[model samples]
Target: HSRGSRALNDGRDVVLMDADDFFISENLCSHISMHRDASEDGSKVKSTFFVKFYQKLHAEGWNLTLISRKPEKLRNATIEHLMAEGCGSWSSLIMRLDNQTQMDSQQLFLRQRTVLQKRGFKIIATISSQMEAIPVPC
Candidate 1:
């Protein structure tokens, strides 16, 4: 909370981005989360800035909903990581567990896109970064 307050009070620009290597900098980011490894236990704390982002948002009446393709346990772990990383306590964040659905990335994206559109949300801008995994013959 103090960190975010400090950033805002200092007139720093708060940016938001997925947890990709491309967007990392010393700049103050308002929010950051893992994209490719969203479900991993260790990936939760791998933010672009710091956990104070969530704290600051909460202070400013921001309700953060964390959607995870991981199990309920891992989702909870992410929250834990947030707290440990400096968000203080993470009781304010909402966690949605998606493991039961077993949806792939494309399916999840389409479903979320439709739902968000129906909710009157529009995508203003999108920056795409592609990652591919190559098979190694044993």
Candidate 2:
């Protein structure tokens, strides 16, 4: 199946997500809204959409990995929200600390991910993006 493709599956594929993009966004127009200042309707709509999306994916055998800056807190909240939305069987979700090194090594760390997969879950270190000292927009 293609990356981010909507192809149906027997349930078991994994979906990789960037926390800032997939789970939360700053602007109401954005697909994901996790920003504290986001409007209630926007946030609720996005969150419900994702909850249902994940439920369908999970039911179809798809796993999800959430890369986030908030660590355990974010993961717990996400699970709680999903459960509250009637999605209670989600398991094997991979949540980790969002750091520049991990982001930079996203592709490069595939080999490590292979190894880490054996452990079920792991939290990697994180740091701010340097990007040649250019300030990244918040």
Candidate 3:
């Protein structure tokens, strides 16, 4: 995120793409297509940006309903259990896992991240940086 700060606040005409948008715009589908069969065994699932993303959402009051194409991968139950353990509203969101991405080559074709607002919701961005196969809920 720090990489674009200089041009961002310079007062010149500037626009920013979230990690996801930059990936699609660059035609680097393979970069984003590498996590389709990620497992929770610690091999496929490596790390998750959900914490960071969640922090962003928490501050913005943006509720999330993740849409993962792999229904079996939904950890909503664990999230609900964690909520029962007192993780708060963030836990309920775990109960709402609602969508999934299509798969190919055991890797995800694409993972879409969107932002929700009172009036509507929109794809805020996409990311192709699969530096490590992060396990979900990491």
Q: Which candidate wins on lDDT? A: 2
In terms of lDDT, model 2 sits at 0.45
Better of 2 and 3 by lDDT: 2
* Model 1 agreement with the true structure over 1-138: per-residue lDDT tens digits: 234432233222222212222123222232353344433433334443334455565476432333333345544455555554555432222223455356554444445444544655442222222221111234
- Each prediction's whole-model lDDT (CA): 0.37, 0.45, 0.31
Q: Sorted on lDDT, highest at the top, how do the candidates line up?
A: 2, 1, 3
Residue-level lDDT of model 3, residues 3-88, one tens digit each, is 22222222222111122211212222233454544342242222234334434543444333432222344354434432442323
Candidate 2 pairs with clashing backbones: 11-60, 11-61, 12-61, 12-62, 25-32, 99-126, 99-127
Model 2: number of clashes? 7
lDDT of 2 by residue, 1-138 (tens): 223545334333445433332333443234343445546556556666666665666555545554443344466675664455566564344444454335543442343355445655442221112122222234
Residue pairs with backbone overlap in model 1? none
Clash counts per candidate, in order, are 0, 7, 19
Model 2: how large is the Cα RMSD against the reference?
Answer: 9.5
List TM-score per model, in order: 0.38, 0.43, 0.31
lDDT of 1 at 104: 58
For model 3, the superposed segments whose C-alpha errors exceed 4 Å read 2-49, 72-75, 81-120, 127-138
The TM-score of predicted model 3 comes to: 0.31
